[model samples]
Every structure is written in C-alpha cells, then in structure tokens.
Target: MTGASAFPRWILPVMSAIAAGVMLALPYNYAGLYPLTWLAFVPLLVAAHGRSAAAHYWLGLLTGLAMYLVATPWMVEFLQRLKDYSLAPALAGAMVFWFLTAQLPAFLMLCWHLCQRFCGHYCLWFFPVLLMVFYGWFPVLFPLQLGESQSAFLPAIQAASLTGVYGVDLMIGISNALVTAGALQAMGWLPGARHTSGVMGGAGVLVLAAWLGYGWWALDHWDRQVSQWPTLSAGLVQSNETPSAAVPAPEPGYSRSWPPEMALSSQLARAGAEVIIWPETRYKGYFEVDQVPGAFQRAVAGLGVPLIFHDAEQQGNGGEFREYNSSLFLGPDGALAGRYRKHRLVAFGETLPLSREFPWLVNWASDYLGDFFANLTPGNDRVTFPVGGVHLVPAICYESAFPGHVARSVGAAPGSPLLVVLSNNGWFGDSRQPWQHASATVLRAVENRVSLVHVMNNGPSTVVSPSGRVLASTPFQERIGLVTDVPYTPAGQVFRSWFTQWPEWFAVVLGLAGLMALLLIRLTRRQA
Candidate 1:
C-alpha cells in the first residue's frame, strides 16, 4: 500500500470532494441513503490527512460547494421565483449563498489541519469533538446539517433529545473519523495508525451499541407517552396558492373575496376540527391588531372554532409605521386572542442584512437593489396562544430552522405546548426546499420532545410526533386540509428536555475540550 505519492497530487482531493458531496447529498435527497452519511466524511478526511493548510482550505471549499449545489440546487429556482430574477442573476445569487455556506467547511478543514500538525495521528480522535463544536456554532444561510441527513433514521436521531443535533453529528463524525483512520493505515499513510484505529474502532462499536440501545428505548417510551397524553384535533389548510406578482391596491370600503384557505377552514370546522391553521401570509391583506374587518370577523366567527393563520400586520402611523410578518390567533368568538410577529426574519428575503443597526444600508441597498429589499420589522417576543386546555407556540417559517429559538419558545409556554410552524414554501415552488424545510422540523420535535404541526403553502404540511415520526403529511403542491389529532402533555403535566433547558451545553463542552487540546499541544512543544 502506498501513500499520497502513489496518486497524482490533485486526484485524491478532487475525487474525495465529489465523493463526499454525493454521499452527503444522497441522504438529504433520498431518505434511504442515510447510512452513507456515516461514511460520508471518510473520503474527505482521508484526502485531507496529509494536505497542506492551503490545500485543506481549497479542498474544504470544494467539498462544501459540491454538497450544497447537489443537495439544494433548488435555491437557484427559489431566487428566480421569489425575486423574479432572470437566470443569470438568480444563478449569481445562488453562488453567493453557496460561497457563504462554504466557509463553515473551510474553517473545519483548517482546524483539522492544525490538529494534525500538533497532535500527530491521534488527532483523528479529536475530529468528532471538532465537528460538534464547529457545526453547532457556525453561521450559515441554511441550517442543513450533517446530522439532519439522519432525520429519517429515527433511532439514530434519538440522541437529539438529550444533546441536540450536535450529539448525532458527533456520533456520525466518530464513525467517519475511525473509518478514515483505518483507510489511511491500510494505505500506509501514517506510522502506528493501525493500533490507533483498532483501539478507537473497538470503543466506537461500544459507543454505537449504547447509542442505538438508547434510541430503541426512547422511541418506545415516547410512542407510549404520546398515546397516553391528551390530544388536540387540529386542521392544517394547504392552499397551494402562490402570492400574485402584483397585489392591486384595495378599493376603499370594498370587500375582498373569501380566500381559498377560509373556505377550507369552514369545511374543516364542519368536520369537527377544534382549531384550524393556515400557512404563512395566506391572507394577502394587512391586519391591524384588535381591528379585524367586519367581513373577516364574520367569516371567522362562523367557523365556531379557534383559528390560527398568518397575515401581514402594520403598526404605528405615518413616519413611524412598521410592517410585520405575523401569525394571528382568533378565538371562537372571532376576537383576536393573540398575535405573534415573526421574530426571525429571513435574511434578504424578509429584511436586508444589517438594516436594523445600519438603516443607511437599507436605503443604500434599496437604491441599488430596488424591490429585492424588504422592510418587515422583526418582533421582540415569542407569543403562545392558549386554545382549549393546550398552548400553541408559533414559529414562522425561518424560525423553525433554529432549534434553540423553537425550544425556548416551547419551554416558555405554560402546560403542554405544540409548536405550530407556518410557512409559505410557495416561494420555492415545487422544489426540494419544501421537503428539506419539512425535514428540519423532525429534529426540532425530537430536540424539544414536543409534537409539531408544520403547515406550509405549496404542500408537505406535516404533523410530527415527539418521537420525530411524521404522523401525517400532505402531498407536495396540493390543495387540501390535513386534519389530525395532535397529542400533547395534559395540563399540570410537565415535559421539558435537558437539551431545551441548555441547548448549547454540548457545544460548550466540546469547545472547552478543543481549547484544552490546543493548550496540551502548546505544552508538548514547550517540553520538547
């Protein structure tokens, strides 16, 4: 067996980049390919084992670009649909997104390079900790994580209940690192690699056994627990309508036609729905807090059930006017129960980056970017609406992608809370974005141990159980109402996750360990 010298200098890095990308993308594109993720990084790690710092950076960037481009080519179509961009501009925007996303992998590879330089072959063991630390903290446009590829693998993701997604990432990372070590040793890349790989492989097997054992127990436990809990009969309306390119200005005192979602809600109520949810911005008109229009109020009161729906809200007057993308809750009496303004605005789509702190940037960008710049103000609080004996915590679109944000909101709610995510995937058209968006909620449900109802425009509206199982879902690009009984902990019964209480604890511990490793390396050099 020969080392890097046996192959052309460029061969390993290029092949490894494409191999890792395809492996990572497959699980996301097809649920059954999840097993590939355990070995996904093996190619990249082996390729990077003896690379220089500069080479590592380029390899990392190439790998990341390949992964996202393959896994989320939908982003380009989304930009064209959302912004009405021509092909060239849409592709340019997607490239910017992909490049920004590549930084996380670039940094990860640079850290691995440093570890190898300092700690010799033993640095392979440190790879998992490094992965947990970096992936947990790295800022990216989309939070499509390595662990999320296992969303369909129920048992593998059970650890998210205790340690969040990072735990699953660490497990997968360990497998890849161990496999990479063995491959390197077999290829004669490093001295003493065989012994290190053998010992780690044994420990890795034991760790995996414990992980799956816990997962098996946890799945059964959650299944039984959910069945015993009280249930809320909820209806989710998927209107399957995209917002018109141009909304005509309202005529004074003229009533708008009943939207398709409203008609769907009426039918759902007739079917004995206790509450009905509408996807984000389903109502095209603006709403003022506590000032429901007469026709709208009458239509809602007619349903005879609580209704949760998304709307645009405006506050203040004249120069101080602020617009918000908000979720509104209406009681059975048609009175506004609560309004949750979206706290997490989509970057660039909902609001321009740095626009709040630097208002001048908004003005400057608006001059150049025109209609691409949105001015929706972010809300300051997470609101929980009480319906019947249960509380519904609302997460609008992009907010559901954030585990900590969703967990904190669920934890803040009194009694058993069901997370209701309202989204308008219509902007992304019939693309992988809808499926990828839906997959994220699976992790959020497990991380918080809360049942979640994700209702989206343009389909794939789903109800996820505490066990991360998709209990019910609508077909993509469908117009229908998905009605289901969502289980929740009864009032006075508490269901809180340790990860919810301290979501960042695992990442913090890993970060500290990384710092200590660097210190040890420094001390070793001093002693020598």
Candidate 2:
C-alpha cells in the first residue's frame, strides 16, 4: 500500500478519471437519488495521496472539468444562440461560465493535496474548510455549491440555521470524507485493520443520526407551521404575453378595442383574487402606447387590484431606441403606482454589450443598445411592495440566480417577506433550463428565509417555501396554478443577513495556513 504511489502512471490516473465520470453521472441521475454530490470528490481526493503539486493541479483540472461539464449543459444554448461567432469563439464564450463557476472544486483539491503530507492521517477533518473556501465569494455567478444537491435531504439540512446553505454543504462534505475514509480502510491503506470496521460503522451511525434528527425537525416544523399559517386569497395569470423588452402595455384583455388577451386578466380578477399577478413580458410584444386608447389606463385603474406587467420600449426619434425590461406595478385603482426595471439584463436577449460599438461582434437584435447602441440600463432599486396583505420582493428574472442580490434587496426590510419572481420561462424550450433556473431559486429562498412564488409565462413556475419545498408549479405552457397562500417566514435566518461568502474563504485560508505550517516544520526537520 505504501509503494502504491510508485505504481504504473496510468493506474491512479485511470482510476481518477473513472471516479470523475461516476461522480458526475451518478449524483446527477435519478437512480443515485441521494444527494451524493460531495461524494464525487472522494476519489479525486484519494488520488492526491503523496503526490507532487503538479500532479495535484491535474487532479484539480479533472475535477473542474467533470463538474462544469455535467452541472451546466445550459451553456450550450448560449453558444448556439450566437450564430455569428465562430464555433471556437462561441464555445470559448460559453466556457467562461465553466471557468468562473468551478474555482472552488479546483481550489479544494489543491488545498487538500498541499496539506495531506503534513496531516499524516488527519487530512479527513480538513475538508470542512474546503467547504468554506468554495462557498465564499462576491457576486457568485452560479453559486451552486455541493450542498445544493442535498436540497431534498432534510437531515443534514438542519445545519442551515447556523451557517445557512453553506453549513449543509459543509456537513455533506464531512459525510463524503467519512465515506472515502471507509473506502480507504477497506483497501488496507491505513493501519489498524481490525479497528477500521468499528470506526466505519460508527461513522455510518453518526451520518444516519444526523440525517434522522434533521428530518424530524423539518417534519415537525412543517406540521406545526401549517396550522398557524394565515391564508390569503390570490390569483396568478400567465398571459403568455410580451410587452417590449421596453414598451408598456394596457391590461391584457382590455385595450379599448377588444385586445387578443381579453379573457385573461378579467378571469384572474373574477377568481376571487385580492391580488392578481401576471407573468413577465405581459406587455413585451409588438405594441405601442399609441395603439391603445389613453383611457385604456383608466379602465384597468377601475379593476381595483394590482396587476404586474413587464414593460419594454425602444428609444425613438434621433435616439437609438433603447429597450428596457421592467416590472410595472399598477395599484388597485389601475394607475401606475410603482416599478422595478429589471436590474439584470440577459447578455444577448436584452442588449448585446459593445456589439454596437465594435460592429464586428455583430449587433444581432432588432433594437439598439443605447443612443447609438449600448447595453440596457439596469434598475438601481430593489422594489418590495405590499399586495394581498404580504410584504414581498418582486424579482423579475435572472436575479434569482444571484442569492446575495436578493439578500441585499430583502435586507433593507425588517424581516423576511414573501417573494414573487415574475418570469417568462417560455424562452427555455422544455429543456432542463427551467429546472436549473428553478433549482437555484430554492437556494435563494432558503438563503433569504422567504416564500417565493415563481410565476412564469411558459413553464416550471413554482411556489417554494423558505426551506425550498415546492408548494405548487405549472407544467410547460400556458397554464394556471394557485399557490393558495405561500407562508411568510418570520424573520431571522443567518444567510439573509450575512452578505459575505466568508465560510468558503475561511476554509481556504485554514487549509492553506495548515499546509504552510507543516512545510515550515518539515524545513526545520531537514535542517536539524
């Protein structure tokens, strides 16, 4: 076992490769239903045993490749969408998503490899810091840590209260380490073969106990919370409508001359909905304000309820006709009460950056970016409004992926509130895009301790609790579903307030610091 490091070069590398494949396919597929995402790292970690830094770096690259390739197939869509770019450039652009997202796993392996020689056998405990290093960062584009896989697992999730989502990720990493340790024991890599069996059994018991304890808490909380929950009557409408990505629209059905969407808004209102919600882009299609009567606004004002619509318009006259994606909140009286122009705009969908200036990038859209051509101006404010007697944050789209963005917005409020993510998932085309997007929302909901209602124009619009439990969701297409009343979490979840991805950083530093100290000690030994 000690000389195994000197074995044929292909042996460990092949094993490492096989492990990466299993790690990627097993955890993501249905049969591996368990959230064994962290388990994937076990073989990669094992491969690092008594290795050179260069060897460790290859291991890091391999880990990153497996994770980035499997976790995000959606990047292909971005590449395919850019018809003008060469296959290589488009692919490169798409791969930036991979480079940006996989820094944690890459670093995790590096940290583990650096410290293993010093830890002797204690390297198992060092992984808790790996979790911290990976989870910590600012403006995390796709902050999908290993813990997210266990969103369906309740036991390990109990740690969410202390460290938010990152804590659950930490515990799962620990569990995965235990599993890898057991595997190593079976291989006779460590001494005390007789005691290995007992130790492994104990670890199994600890994992099971932690899992069961958390499950009990979640079940108990659900049962008790439901009875005390205040019910509110609300109606949701998915208009399958598009305003401009800038032009505003009158109410869907009533634009003076019997618009195409006549029955939609009125039906939602008639359904006893105190607050009738509409999907994003309810006003995004080829319609101008002049097309509707000036009194059309007055007519909806009479509906006596709030209706949310996405507004878009191209700037006119001498200007380049800029476009805006916005959420329009009309008061019960139908007059425009408030608005949150979408803060985050899609790279190509909203406005292509610098494409207008460079021209070589090819401005593909029908609209202009700025006065001549620029990116759409993002909204500066996070608009939280009251409707149906609940305080809420209305995120238009894409903002859900950025948990810290929601936290920053919701943080301004005294406590957590119900959340409404008005979206047009219709664009994704029945692919796993909706699932990926919706899955990330759960992280945001749990992180903020808020009930989120994802109302979509096309598919996978769901209502999720602070725990990321799905209450109700529509299938693909022009569908309707009631969330009944989403439960508003009573304030105080650590993540909602804790802005820094500090836990991830601490892990990195700890691992790095530990490795450094051991190196210094080794140097002193050589001198002595």
Candidate 3:
C-alpha cells in the first residue's frame, strides 16, 4: 500500500484510546459534562475501523484502564491508606485495582471479535447488544454504565424502564458506529464518498434526537397513565461516623455511643416520620438470637418506630467461621423482625474470591491486615420487612449497584415495595465515589419504578421517585438527616418484568440468530 493509502495504525489506536478515555472520565469528574458520554466511544470506533483484531483489543484495554484511572481516583486512596503499612502491599493493591478496571474492556474486545467474525460489516449493529447481554451478566466494579450519564436527563433515563440500562447503551453504541463510519470515510480510511459519510453522520444525529424525543413522549405518557399513589413519610439519618473493620479502635472511654446518634432519628420520628433508617454496619456487634447489643436494642425500643440498620455477622464454627454483611429490621417492639444479607459481595473488598482454597492467604491477611475482605460470605436469601401496609426491600452498600440484585429483592409483593438502601461510604471520604454511588440509586429507582430511601453513613442520602427524580437529599460529608414523603408508583410497571425477566436473554438469542443467518449467507455465496 502507498504511504497515503496505508493506515496510521499506531496513531489511530492512540487517538482512539485517549479520546474515549477522556470522554468517559469527563462525566465522572464533572457531572455537568455528561454529554461527553455519547461521544466517548466514537473515537474508539473510528480507530477500530479497518484495524486488525489485535489492534482493536489493545486499544480497548488501554481506553478502559485510562478511563478507570481518571474516573475512579478514589481507588488510589485505599492504596494511600495502606501506604503507611509498606510500599510493596500498596503497589500490589494498585496492580489489582488496575487489573480489575481492565476486565470489562478485555471482555468487550472479545465480544467485538466474535461479532466481527459472525456479522462481518454488520457487526457494529450488534456491538451494544452484545455489551448489554454480557455486561448485565458480568460482575462489574460499578453498575454505572452509559445509561447513567443521562441520569440527570429523566426523559432519556425513562427508556431504562423498557430495556434497562442496555437500551441506552445500545443507542450509544450504534451512534458511535455511525459516527466512526462517517469519520473514516471523510478521512479516506474507507472507500465511501464523503457525501455518503455525511448522510450517515446526519442519520446518527437524527437517531439521537429521536431517542430524546421518545424519552420526552415516554415521560409524558407515564405521567398521564399512572395515578398518584400514597407517599410514605420516611427519615434517613446521615452520621459523620463511617464504619470500617480496617480502622483502628478509639482509645478506652472514647465511647462513640448510639444515644447521641439516636437523637436525630428521635427528632425525625417526633417530627412525624413513620420509619427511620441507619447506615450500614453502624452497629458493629454480631447480631444473633443469643447476642444483640443492649444499646441498639434500647434505641429500637425508644424510637417506637421501625428502625433499619446493617451489621457484619460472624457465623459458623471453627474453620467454617463465615462472615456476613447484613441489614436487620427492628420492629417498634425492639425485636428483630427480619434480616437480609447482602447478596452481591464486593469481589476483593468484601470477600476474597478463592480464599477457601487458599486459607493461608486469608489467615495472613486477617492476622496482619485486619481481615479487610477475606471472610465476608455471600447471602443466599431475600428478606423483606413489613412496615405499616408495605414491604421494605433492603439493599446494603455495593448491593445497590446491581440492578438484578435490587429487582429480585423487590420481588412480586402485594404492594409496590420501597427499596431501602443502607450504605456507609465514609471509607471513600469526600471523593467522587459518593456521587457516583448516588447515581446508581437513581437508576434503581427508575428501573424498579419504586421509591428508594438511601441512608448513607457519610452523606448524599436521597429519597428518589419512580421517574428518577430526587425528592429530597442531604449533601455529602454532612452529619444531617432527611425527612420526605417518598412517592411510590403502582405495582406491575413494565420495567420490573423486563429487568427481572428476559430482555438480556432475548438480546443474546437475537444476536445468535443473526450470527447463524450470516454464516448461512456466507456459505451460500461461497457455494455459488
């Protein structure tokens, strides 16, 4: 190939990686720049055009790493905390952090390769479909995806009800492909005329416009169709104290007691809140039939309202001793009503993946590092607590990130259950982690069409409506409380079925069918 005709292979990939990385990092860094999310993958797609599979794969991995580094800088804070321990462990933690970030990119590139082989030129159409299918099933660090960038845009987010987050992701992927194709042609990377590319580019713009228009229509239609339902008066307590097993214990008589903390809840209840919420694992003791903290029990009795709190439990015997991160419901009678263990554990943060086989590593980590994540066991059952006339589904920290986890927790209750998300984000401090974490709850509220009461240990606790609207919220790092009448939509919304049931599987089957049809077509053409 002539110099003019030859692809600037390295340069294109680098450009794609940088552009995609910056675009993704922009939304996370500054919420106002969320519009950048639409354009994030465009450069990457442009670079992928007429490139080798290996090149595309490498470019994708680099973009993912860069994006995570920029977006999740708080991850480094964990390493910084460990820095005083020693340099080697800190470096090891950093390596693990970067590797975790690279996971989705690696999987995405593999999907891209498969699509390319199956669909040929039409693979771009399946890009986002594959993404939705794989990502929904894949265990990701954060459930924050393309759909979340539009969290502020309620109309756009409303589509998440029909297709979950994947719907928005699909639109984004198609838009990027269209833009990439047009750009490639305009830049002479493709054989198509610039005019053809322009039309394609214009079509992509129209698609985006139409999407927004549909969102507007959906929002209007939803508003018209649903009758106003009852609102519950709920109170959320946001304490300044963040609970962590890794932190050093306060000196003797430094007692950070619950009496002072219960003051906020007591005031909220007297102000007419029907329920009160406490942050995750705020009560550090192991809650069991035999042993429950006296102070916590008394606080529950004093409140005279259903109080919700989470704790870390130590269960089993001897070598089988397993830890659980659980949320407990204490009735007005100060008795344990029900409990829900956190279903999805944070991979390395809550539970070590292969610790059963590597007991030595678990022992060492526990002995030296205070068992930060080596023992927490995953929960198997969904426990819903009844308050007044409604059931409350409990979602602990990290569990709120998973749409499926939230969906299952809600279940098919007699009435629309309110999702209560209890979290202690103090570990992250005044970082973007809290903001990013809040974004997921918004998506959950929309997807489940249920009002959510998010009670955080640090801050940013919010009461969200079915339409992804924040009814009330407290700012981050504040020691404050919130009282609001959280609105609930009627049961049997379309989203609960789609998200909880089969849309992802449908996408997968559709892609597989397309792949098979393409293979058959190729065979026929070869024969002819």
Candidate 4:
C-alpha cells in the first residue's frame, strides 16, 4: 500500500462518496440511526489521505453532490406541487438546492487538502476548526450540520448553546479527522506510519470518550437543576388543512376568515392549558386591530384563554400595501396582544432572492412563468408575544431553520424562555419534509436553552424541551391537537449568554489562524 501501484486510486474517492451518502441517509432520512454520523466521514478521510489537491477537489464536489442529493429529496416535493407536475421542474429545483447546500462539503475538503499539503500530519485536528469557520458563514436553510445528528445524544449536544450548532459540528469533525489520520497511518499512507497510528488512534478514542463523558455530566447536572423549575401547560393544535389552489394575489385589505375549533380550545382549557396555539394561517384573515370581525373577536373572548395564530396584513408605505407573514397573538379579551412578522422568507416561495438588485428580472420572471408567488415583505425586527406567564419567540414557518435568528430573538427578550414555531406544511404534501422541518426545532431548543413549541398545519405538531428532547408530538399528517407540559429550565443559558455577547468571533479566529499558519508554512518551504 506504500507504493502508488499497491492501491487503486478509485478506492479512496468511491469509498468517500459512499460514506457520505450513508451518513446523510441514516440521520436525515427516516432510518433514525443518528449515531452513524460520527463515523460517516472516516471513509472519506481515509480516501483523501494521500490524494493531490486536484484529486481532493473533485472528491469534495462528488461527496457534496451525493450528500445533498440523498439528504434533501424533500425539496422536489414543493416543485411537484406545481400545476400538473413534470420531471423537468422537480429536477431543476433539485439542481438549485444541490448547488447551494453542497458548498459546505466542498469547502470542508478544500480545508483538508490545504492542511495535508502545508501544515503536515498535526493539521488533522485542525480540520474541525476550519469546517466550523466555513459553516458559520455558509448560508443555507435550517443548517443540517454533522453535529445536529447527535441531538439525540443530549450530553454531546449540550455544547451547542455555547457555540451554536458549530461547537458540536467541530467535535464531530475533530473525531472524524483523528480516526481518518489513524486509519491512513495504519494503511501505510503517512510518513511515520506505525508511530502516528498509535498516537492518532489513542487520541481519537480519548476525544470520543471525553465527548460522551461531558454529555453524561451535563445531562445529570441539568436534570438536578431543572427539577426545581416550574413547568408550563401548553396546547398545540393541528388541523389537516391544506392551502387552496387558487391563492388570491395580495390586495389592499382583502379579509378572509376561518373560525378556530372552539371544541378543541375548550377541551385543552379544561385539561389545564393556560395557552392555546393554532397552526399557521389556520384563520384566513388579514386581521388588524380596528378591522377584526365582531364574530371572531367575540369567539376568542369567550374562549377564556390566550390564543396564538398566524395571518397576513397590508402595510401602508406611501399608500402601497406590502404583505407580511405575521404571527398574531390574541389575549383573553379577544384583542391583539402582540405580533412577530417572519424575517427569514423561503427562497423563491415567499420572496425572490436578489430581486432587490435585479428588479426588472422579477417582473420578467413573473410575466413569463405566471407569477408563482407574491413578493411578500420580510420583517426587520424580532418580535416576542406574551401569553399567560410565557414570553414567546414566534418563529413563523421556515424561520426555525435559522438557529442564529431564533437565538437572537430569544436573546432580545432574555426573560422570554420559550420559542413557538407556526408552520403551514401542507405545501410539502405527504413527503418526509414535515418530520425534517420539525427536526430544526430540536436544535433551536438546545441552542437557546428554551422550550420549543411547534404547531403545524397538516400534522406533526411537536413540543421540545430545553434539553432537545421531544416530549409530545402529533402523529404525521394527523388532524388532531396535542397537549403537553413542556419543561421550563435554564440549561442552555450557558451557551446563550456566551453567544449573545461574542457570536462567531471565536470560530473566525480559529479558522483564520489555521489559514495563516498554512500560508506561512508554504512560504517557508518555497524560501528553502
């Protein structure tokens, strides 16, 4: 194996691609085998050990293409919902999603190649740092990083609050790199093969042990601390309702109304629910304080409990009305208590990307393609709603995927220790997307150390604790409401407090320092 002729070149790249595919399938797909994520990249690492820069570049792109292609078939579900679905549109959307999300893998492998070439064997441990830096900046929806897979491993993921999801991502990267380095040495791919194997193998085991050990201690400590905190009885409502095929264009004050289920509200109240939640757009009205219907107001007034729902409204900017995806909160008095407008709009679904820069293209696309979506207004500030004793960070629809946005919302109201996600997932149909979307709430809960309440239209309403544990959830696609006492504890504040002041600077510095070291080493070699 020491000689180039001893091993086939294709072995490394092929194994690398297969490992990446398996890793994505296990954690992201319905397999639910998240533990496999830790070892998923080992095969790739082994393949990459003796590779040249050009070889690593192609391998990285290939691995990224495989990872995203397997992990996110759910993207095609939306395109398929088009008027009489065709393979062309679905394939087109898949290509866009793959191109955007695949950058992280390509960036990661580039880091590995650079480290191996300039920084030598010791740089294996630095791969995680570089990966973290790149991931911190990479823009994608609901970042499904390597570390988020270990969300089920409570102790291991407890570090998320401190570094957001990047900390856990770093740990996974470090462990994988260590294992890869050791394996390469054993395969006679390194300079001091025998000695390096002992060092790397022992280091990898120690790192894994420490990671698990830290998790156990954190969980045990958090459990004892949380036992003293008071819990809240929250009710989540899900009605199997899909959006109408003919969604009317946004006009000035176009009001639509669908009364919420009063029987379910009464049942939840009778069961000691102080707060009741309805799924996004369950009530189809452009509600305003002065324009709310008398019957709707009277109905909410009679409920005797605070209610949370979503609606759209017209905002006047020089007499032009812009619509927003707003989270509406109604008090017991049937009056608007608070509102949080959705900030993160879905790509090409609500608002077109880069439409601000290329305004003419917006009109061009609309004219040619028949206006697929209305240009909805994105919110500027984080808004919190208070119902009963809980202050809620209302993450509407796709906002749950952006951990930093959710964290900033929670950070805005330090007193507010809860996050509520209202989503209308009917657009995605019966695909695995509902479950995949719900997974983001788990990471959000851990990142902010808050209780997360997810209410969705057309199923899978979930209640997650500060520990990232799912306490209660409605079955997928079920038309039923769920009531659960979501835990209230301050375990995640450790990361929250740290992140609020110093965001990703630590990761930035680590990545920059590694790059600088690599550049210096390359220069020294050139000078020699």
Best by lDDT: 1
Clashing pairs in 3: none
lDDT of 1: 0.83
lDDT of each candidate versus the true structure: 0.83, 0.59, 0.70, 0.71
TM-score of 1: 0.94
Q: Which portions of model 2 miss their true places by more than 4 Å?
A: 1-15, 21-32, 82-104, 117-120, 135-141, 188-212, 239-263, 282-299, 312-325, 341-374, 414-416, 478-483, 489-528
How well does model 4 score by local distance difference test? 0.71
Q: What is the alpha-carbon lDDT for the whole of candidate 3?
A: 0.70
Q: What is the lDDT of residue 166 in candidate 4?
A: 76
Which parts of model 1 are misplaced by more than 4 Å? 1-8, 248-257, 288-292, 367-372
Which residue window of length 10 is worst by lDDT in model 1? Answer: 246-255
lDDT of 4 by residue, 110-152 (tens): 7778777775766676777776766666777546666656656
Worst 10 residues of 4 by lDDT: 249-258
**Tens digits of per-residue lDDT for model 3, 375-416:** 688889877788876678888888887766677777555566
Instruction: State the displacement of the C-alpha of residue 41, model 3, in Å, after optimal TM-score superposition.
Output: 1.1
Q: Tens-digit lDDT track for model 1 on 140-193?
A: 877777777788999998879888888998998888887887788888997866
Whichever of 2 and 4 has more TM-score, that candidate is 4
